[model samples]
Target chain A: DQQVKQNSPSLSVQEGRISILNCDYTNSMFDYFLWYKKYPAEGPTFLISISSIKDKNEDGRFTVFLNKSAKHLSLHIVPSQPGDSAVYFCAASARGAGKSTFGDGTTLTVKP
Target chain B: DTAVSQTPKYLVTQMGNDKSIKCEQNLGHDTMYWYKQDSKKFLKIMFSYNNKELIINETVPNRFSPKSPDKAHLNLHINSLELGDSAVYFCASSQPDRDGGYTFGSGTRLTVV
Candidate 1:
């Protein structure tokens, strides 16, 4: 069974607009959530992360909002660019679990 | 320079053949892990090692084995490769302090026919 779920397989958005990706989890033990952006033929690179203690974390153009009570998290990218057209994966982990559980991934295409 | 590097980026072998993928990390991280991404693009953890010690071993097949020679190196060896073994195998490293921010290799695409 998948502990982390990204129901959306793909999303399209216009450049300079907002793009939101959603993820849900079944495990309450997961306290840390992370997002990674992956290009074809390459490994995933860290995008953003949020801790259960905090509801939101932002870095420049990327922001991650966590709803602990809902066991859900969403990643928001404002003014999305064509370079942002890549697969995004949501992952969750707990302390000492070391390993993370990753969703199937969401492909976001930022149209130009 | 790539922090996590895996050699032989692509491998194509016949079924029942044995193949091995090597991975190394330059960062002085204490933990390393192996993850598999299937055709469906689902990423799953296979194994994890810390200081050359086996830490987390997922519900993987016995044909797959992970060996860590040093803290910076982890290798995956698969025997009797099956058709379903065709997938992208990723090697990753994470510092214990960063929670779970992992540095991943470019990934080795293995195709078993």
Candidate 2:
């Protein structure tokens, strides 16, 4: 069973516009959530994350909001740039699990 | 220097042949993991090791074996490779307790002809 799910397979947004990516999880035990961005051939790089205790976390132009009650999370990039186009994955990890479960990933295309 | 590195970026071999993928991490992280990205682009965890100790083994085939010589390295060996084994394999390291997230290798693309 997939504990983490990114329902949208792809997304497109104009440059300088807001881009939002959504993710949902089924496991209530997951306490930490992370977002990673991956290019065509390279591996995924960490983007942003939020703890179960926190509702929102921001870093520069990227922000992550988590809702524990809904078992959902989202990544928001304000004024999306063309360089932001890539596959975004949402991963969730539970306490003492020692490993994180990843979603199928959503490909984001920022048109310039 | 690369935090996590995997050798043989691309491997193409005939079915029934045996091949191995080597991975090493310069980072002194205590946890290492192997993940496979299939044609569908779903990254699935194959195995996870903590300080050379096997911690998590998914429902992967028995033909696939993972060896951790130390905390800094994790290698994957496949016996009698099948056509279905073709995919990109990624090596990742993380400090689970620190919540620092994971660092992944560029990935090794394997194609079984």
Which candidate should be chosen as best, given DockQ against the real structure?
2
Q: How many Å off is the CA of A54 in candidate 2? A: 0.8
Name model 2 segments beyond 4 Å from true: none
Model 1 chain B: lowest-lDDT 10 consecutive positions? B94-103
Per-residue alpha-carbon lDDT of model 1 for A4-73, expressed as tens digits? 9999999999999999999999999999999999999899999998999999999888999999889999
Q: Residue by residue across B7-102, what tens digits does model 2's lDDT show?
A: 889999999999999999998999999999999888899999999999999999999999999999999999999999999999999886846699
In terms of lDDT, the poorest run of 10 residues in model 2 chain A is A92-101
Of the true contacts between chains A and B, what fraction does model 2 have?
Answer: 0.72
For residues A1-112, write the lDDT of model 2, one tens digit per residue: 8899999999999999999999999999999999999998899999998999999999999999999999999999998999999999999998888888999999999999
